[model samples]
Target: MTSHRNPAHSLNWHPDWSSGGDLTLLSSDEIAFSVPSRPILAVSPALRPGAGGLLPLPLSLRLVLYFLDLALYGQLDFLGPSDNYLTDVLSLAGWLDSLGATSLINLLLVSGRAQRWPLAVEFLLGARLRRTDLCREALNRFNDDGRWRDTVWQPPGTVSDFATLCPRALPLDLWSSVDRRFMWAWVVADVPDTPPSFGLGDKFLEIYQTP
Candidate 1:
């Protein structure tokens, strides 16, 4: 009698698979048993094209792009202090973190540069700033300490306060929770005061009372 061979044996399977076809698909446990997953890919500025075209950028420009990418991806400490790059990097990092990138907030906290305190406060009241312990520690060092004037007490209070106080702190939609809350509180607290009438109120009303 002639026997038929199984087609499963002829099929190729990835290392991620158990045998072949969907019959022996890799399970979650099997995947965990395999090689460890690599870290998330970071976009490199070296891979980016310049104004001239798709060619290697200048060293200075490359450096700037690298830091900017890191800041965008919420990886700020990767940027070091060279040619005032740290200032720009920290500022950008803070801005990114303010926009809900918690990873950048953690990086900025560990980097230990208080120069970004204003942005940090903005993040504290708005962004999902992780590592609460670290964030509080950094705030204490940068704000609660004697550096309050330089960091916390800038011209405007929150984003709205900034807009009201400066008119250029941010765009209209950039209001923070603190800003809205403070404004609401101000409006609620500001009761209009009644002025003293110079003459009798009855006489004033008589001139136009339902005539």
Candidate 2:
């Protein structure tokens, strides 16, 4: 169905999506986005239109349209290093159950692109996403990159406390798994066979302490 954009409705129409849109979606805030059916349907099979080729979803217009744009272009670099942006991307992907978007985000998180982010961000995102590999990668970075640890110790006072990074404390089981990985890394290191009491002990206690 063809949809017309009305500027008076405060409708922010995206140039690319507005051009080839067949499916019309209504956001919770009453914004209308005319997006192509092909790109969204290709990734989200469960997404369907109602009468008049319209679908109402409980999401902000930007949330819905941004996701569709990502699906349209299959771009991963759209993500920012901030936790909120990453969380929003993952939340939208999961809500839509779009495997393509989910995989794209996962790949982005695990790639060199994420390496520039604070290892704490990587670790927390990994834990939040329940991807063990990412947690391990962050821990591995901590072991390899002394600079990361130094930052954790002397956080420029601008960064958020590691303990306050994520909204919720990691589940006890996940914390235990990460703790085990840290212990394993220490075991395999060439240093004297002692615990992480050197410097990492305080960092771990400060950050990963389970509630």
Candidate 3:
């Protein structure tokens, strides 16, 4: 919890599924969120070379800590302001730290839409650039989602260096999911649009015709 804003605005909301919990989702203006799980880690800014962080906690050893009993006992109010300025940067950074640079670039674009630039830039610069089957799988699923429509595909200004990030490009496995949730970020950044000299355009065709 960032603990900087109103304590209630942070990850302080209790999920409404426990005892005395009403599983009613509020309109976007309300704060009752049904957010999915994100990764967990803590680190510093990337611009300052002296700032410190470590290799991410591997995905194989994933651990989720949700205290259902605690939420049930407290029954905390789920309502709060709709503004994302109340978003906890520290919490967002922790989640971003768990993903590689390739994925972080996409997430940063999403955060940029919410105006969480502090966390977005932090994740973008610090993220590791690696392409794995897992990343490909996740991207494939995103391509299938309604959110991937071109109208909403706005990535931030931070993804311009994708060519330098991964030079030896690999082809996408059309049969597999290929997690390209943030592919639009690269497009908006102009790195993958022209098929960079870096040799990694295998995913360009299918992702371009995502419909």
Q: Write the per-residue lDDT of candidate 2 for residues 63-155, one digit (tens) a residue.
A: 443343332222222111121222233333333322333553444444323344435545655554556677777767765754321111222
Q: Which should have the higher lDDT, number 1 or number 3?
A: 1
Worst 10-residue lDDT window for candidate 3 reads 60-69
Ranking by lDDT: 2, 1, 3
Report, for every candidate in turn, its global Cα lDDT versus the true structure.
0.29, 0.36, 0.29
Cα lDDT tens digits, model 1, 123-157, are 33232333434434444454334322211112223
Q: Name the runs in model 2 displaced over 4 angstroms.
A: 1-102, 109-112, 118-121, 149-211
TM-score of 2: 0.27
What shift in Å separates residue 187 of candidate 3 from its native position after superposition?
17
Q: Which stretches of candidate 1 lie over 4 Å from their true place?
A: 1-54, 78-158, 162-166, 173-211
Candidate 2's displacement at residue 162, Å, is 5.9
The ten-residue window of minimal lDDT in model 1 covers 6-15
Which candidate, 1 or 2, would have the higher TM-score against the true structure?
2
Candidates' TM-scores?
A: 0.21, 0.27, 0.22
Clashing pairs in 2: none
Task: Identify the runs in model 3 with alpha carbons over 4 angstroms from their true place.
Answer: 1-6, 11-131, 148-211
lDDT of 3 at 116: 27
Superior by lDDT: candidate 1 or candidate 2? 2
